[model samples]
Target: MKRYARILAFGAALAATVISSSAAQAETILKASHQFPGGKGDIRDEMVQLIAREVAAAKVGLTIQVFPGSSLFKPNDQWNAVTRGLLDITSFPLDYASGRHPEFSATLMPGLVGNFDRAMRLNDSPFMKNIKSIIEKQGAIVIADAWLSGAFASKKGCITAPDTMKGQVIRAAGPAFEEMLAAAGASIGSMPSSEIYSGMQTGVLDAANTSSASFVSYRLFEQVKCLTAPGENALWFMYEPVLMSKRIFEGLNADQQKAILAAGEKAEAYFNEEVRKGDQLMIDTFKKAGVEVVEMSKADYDAWLAIAKQSAYKNFAAKVPGGEKLIEEALAVK
Candidate 1:
């Protein structure tokens, strides 16, 4: 009977070792989704892969499964998906969630951010701290800050003046931008950037303002006759950071959480470099496709800014919480 008892103890000890081994090898997988495609050398795809690689390098049993091109969730639904725990992470345009979280509207307010350098600086500002608190309250965390400069695509001609928007049905990325166009005399049709192609195809949209990467990725040049491409003089830049669910992030082990954040930092640098490259790529692609590529000049930008302040900025400050102060800090980036 004593021998049998000893044998039973030994069996229990072996089972415990096996269980420990399995636990050590288990991977903590977070599914990351985005509205862009996973293309070869595509910055969005490449950066996501970098994040995955960094987490793996940490050897903390943490990894990310990427669902690019909005396969996991649509662009408009990503924030809701992540916050509700239906999705774990996303490369989200903060402005897209402005409807639900009005404070996010200021992130894409016209004339607030135009250059990558200033956008990076904004990340360290008290304004960003306030934005972070607002987002955290909504159950998400900003993992990476991405400032992707964008441009205007038009069906008939270059969109230079407020009058150029008159009577046109445009797809502006955010409500703030739409308000500016409306105040200038344009009909607004809200849709995610990914749907710009279809909107143009159906003739429902006469113009769109979107990221440089998306301009090329969706081949808007084929549908539109002209593009006000991103460059040294552009006011269409956007803040589309990669975000993770606060619930998921907080539930992670310390090592795993650190790995995720470290990976995000690395990916953000990649984003800045590649987004600039994308701007040039969009210009080349549009020109090569026989689309007239117009650039915003000092005068043109000033005109847009004038209207934006009176319409977009004013509307945002009046509606979104703390938006006026946020705009003050954003414009002070100089």
Candidate 2:
């Protein structure tokens, strides 16, 4: 009887231990948020999903819970939410935060950084290192950087020269963009991309500037009749920052950090490829939609660059601490 009793006690103890161990192995949930609608199927969402998959594969006890379409916060509030640890991760355009960190406006500066290859190199270069330190000071870590090709859409007609843009009511997103359009003699109304389509249909806007992805996502093609050529003035290559709260990142173990970084690298590569392919598809779609694609003259492009160098850079430098240094480093990245 004593031996049977001992055997029962041992079995119970082993079962309890197994249950506790299993509980401990359960995945930790990390919440990620973005401003886009969940159904949009944008590249940003794809990258987040990729990270979640990688985390699961590594069996690191980490799981990502994505909050799409700004359910937790609006697009402009995303940075603050992430920094305050309300969101574990987020990806957004750096230009959106220029009011908080004016140097970030450099990311949208006209004629500053052109082409994906050059932009990618600059992202990993010393320029990003400095920018990263600044962002960290605000309580977030920038893990990946990417550029989306921008284009101009007009409700009335195509604009092929700076002179033709005069008196146009153009909807632009950032101060630098507003300045660029203003320099080209267009009347500027700054608004979020979400508001652009309606702004055009109601005649609140005559032109709008955005990426090809945006044109399609917002269905702006239905209202706009033309798309400026891809390479002309490089439109406005928006830079996206893949960021996480500093506290969340620091709490991770070393091995976990390695997995996150590795996954981020893969996400970055995939993002670049997707943006390129998406741009081409958008171009083809625009052509099929009967949108006239026009390229600006070299002289006009040069004139715009000269104006940006003199006015935009100076205005931006005055607003941001160490802004000129940031610009110099970015331009020097080659």
Candidate 3:
């Protein structure tokens, strides 16, 4: 009987040691990358930091390492990298992945989303659900939902009127907007926003379209002489969501998934609030920089919309499968 009791005690000790070893080795690590600068000031950076804070506070045996300003991957490469598991997550603009899914180009369709409230409703909207469905199949999921409104800038003059862009070189953020700019008779320049600075300086770009926040963040105001800001409502609205690879997310335990998702949702709310304020803040930044700033007027906006209908809208419906249904769903959002 004494010998039997000793064996039982030894078995209990071994079980406890095994459990402790499992606990020590169970940490889940996520590598997050983005094109925006991290640390502070910038909204994306701040939100990502907030997410990290919340994760740490939860103590879910999970940790995420952040790489900002394309340190880990280029802006265009981040999406595919996340899907390939070379990256775990990214703060990505969907339009950049339009090549992977042409339907994604609709996210940047002119006048589709002009303000925060309408833009915020997109994730649940049927139109966006369809888009998300396609993205989910490609091995990624949106952990955060945020939209950014954009504006146009020119080197010598404002691109307020469609006719004004005649014969000028321009960068129109994405293909949809690019089609509109091309219809306006502007020669389209293909490059990322980071390249826009040097492009403008070297006479490669006469006018460029980008997010309101980027206008100030990239300091293009210092490089360009004229800035067109989103005033009240603008045609350029891009859906920039932080996406996580489905394989990595599904690999987490329920507790870890819950904690990370909750953090991501909170970060998205913070991002939306920052983006709303950023529109006006960028305009102010440009004005103070001694740059001539112009807001798109209603008449010019209407004219641009007319051009877009013939260019971007028509092309999307003809080219992308189910594009017509998506457009109808988006237009019926109101």
Candidate 4:
């Protein structure tokens, strides 16, 4: 009996040691990258960081390291990197990859999403479903669905009317917005949001269109004299979501995958709660700096939408397959 007891104890200790070794071997570290500034209240960065924290707390043998402010990948290159498995994850603006996937241009189309509520509603719409389908096909998957509303800031004048953009050198975020601004007679200069400050400071850009959070985060009030903030007739809404490489995601064990997904949900919920405050912060910060802030009137919005239909909308429908259907699906939400 004594001999049998000793043998059983040895077997139990060996099994415990093997399980401990396996658990240690299972820990994984993923790199998460984004273009926004970290540790400075950029909502996009906060989203990524929240994911990191949540996953760490889950104790699921998974850890994420965040690289913000274009530290790891340039803004436009993140989509390509993540989809190719060179990057583990990213907080990315989907339209930035539209050069390779023309259908993604619809995500940033003018007048497609005009307000926070509509932006939220569109997440479940066929338009986004199609967008996500494309993402999956490209070897990445959306972790969080984030829609940011933006506005125009001009050193020349308030950009409330189509004519106001005339002759001004402008930096618009994506191809669709650039097309619309070009049709309005503005000279278009393309650059990432991080460059907007320097572009305006050096006279390379007389105006820019970007998210409200960027205005405050980049201190654009120091560069531009007037801001066209989003109000009742918001015009610019862009989908910027946290994404993971499908290939990398598939490599994770089931527990690690569950932890990552849960972290994403928590991060998304945090964004929805903070985004409105971010917009307000932009408005207040600009006002305190004595920059003129204006909202687009209903009439102004209608005029811009009409121009968009003629230029951006018309071009997209004619160029991209199934583009018209995507627009119809987005509009049908309301």
| Best candidate according to TM-score | 4
lDDT per residue for candidate 1 within 180-244, as digits (tens), equals 88888999998898899999999999999988888888878889998987666778878888888
lDDT of 2 by residue, 31-73 (tens): 8887655667577777877887887788777888888767877
Q: How do the residues 1-334 of candidate 4 rate in per-residue lDDT, one tens digit apiece? A: 9999999999999999999999888878899999998888899999999999999999988889999999999998999899999999999988899999999999999988988888899999989999999999999999999999898999988999899999999999889999999999999999999999999999999999999888888889999889998888888988999999999999998888998999999999899889978778999999999999999899999999999999999999999999999999999999
* Predicted structure 1, TM vs. truth: 0.91
- By TM-score, the better pick of 3 and 4 is 4
lDDT, model 2, position 57 = 87
Model 2: which ten-residue window has the lowest total lDDT? 229-238
RMSD (Å) per prediction: 3.8, 3.0, 4.0, 3.2
lDDT of 4: 0.92
Measured with C-alpha atoms, the lDDT of residue 236 in candidate 2 is 66
TM-score of each: 0.91, 0.90, 0.92, 0.93
**Candidate-wise lDDT, in order:** 0.85, 0.80, 0.86, 0.92
Worst lDDT run of 10 residues, candidate 4, spans 272-281
Top lDDT hit:
4
lDDT, residue 298, model 4: 92
After superposition, which runs of candidate 1 have C-alpha atoms over 4 Å from their true positions?
A: 1-25
Q: Is candidate 2 or candidate 4 better by lDDT?
A: 4
**How should the candidates be ordered by lDDT, best one leading?**
4, 3, 1, 2
Task: Name the 10 consecutive residues with the lowest summed lDDT in model 1.
Answer: 39-48
